[model samples]
Target: MALVKEGDTITIDAHARSLHLHISDEKLAHRRANCQPLPPRYIRGVLVKYTKLVSSSSLSALTDFNLF
Candidate 1:
């Protein structure tokens, strides 16, 4: 998960929240605590097709952050 974002404090459990927010930890910046559970299926396959894009883009982005 660190590849797309940071902090293990965040979660992707759609069953725990009202809306499925595919968001980052910054969304919790104003919150008191983040107790959201981690759902294994939530947004699971969404990245399958983007895998190659993510890998190559990330590698290219490392040398040129502008690509991100």
Candidate 2:
């Protein structure tokens, strides 16, 4: 877990297997104590299809940040 002040943004890997969140720490304790549980919502995932050459060329183009 990471602690950040307002206006800060943190990134986490969604596919990471060994990730853990420690709420007992002082920073997160308040959130754990006050928040109520909510039902999970369903979100549709997007699927992309790319051939070998197409993916390689796309990745090469992506090296230039302005493309996106």
Best candidate (score: lDDT): 2
Which residue runs of candidate 2 sit more than 4 Å off their true CA positions?
1-8, 18-24, 38-68
Clashing residue pairs, backbone N/CA/C < 3 A, model 1: none
What clash pairs does model 2 have? none
lDDT of candidates 1 onward, in order: 0.45, 0.47
Per-residue alpha-carbon lDDT of model 1 for 1-68, expressed as tens digits? 22333433444667875433355556545342544555544354656545423546536524334665
Give a tens-digit lDDT track for model 2, residues 1-68. Answer: 32433554455567875544533466567655666665435333332222211335646734345657
Candidate 2 TM-score over all chains jointly: 0.26
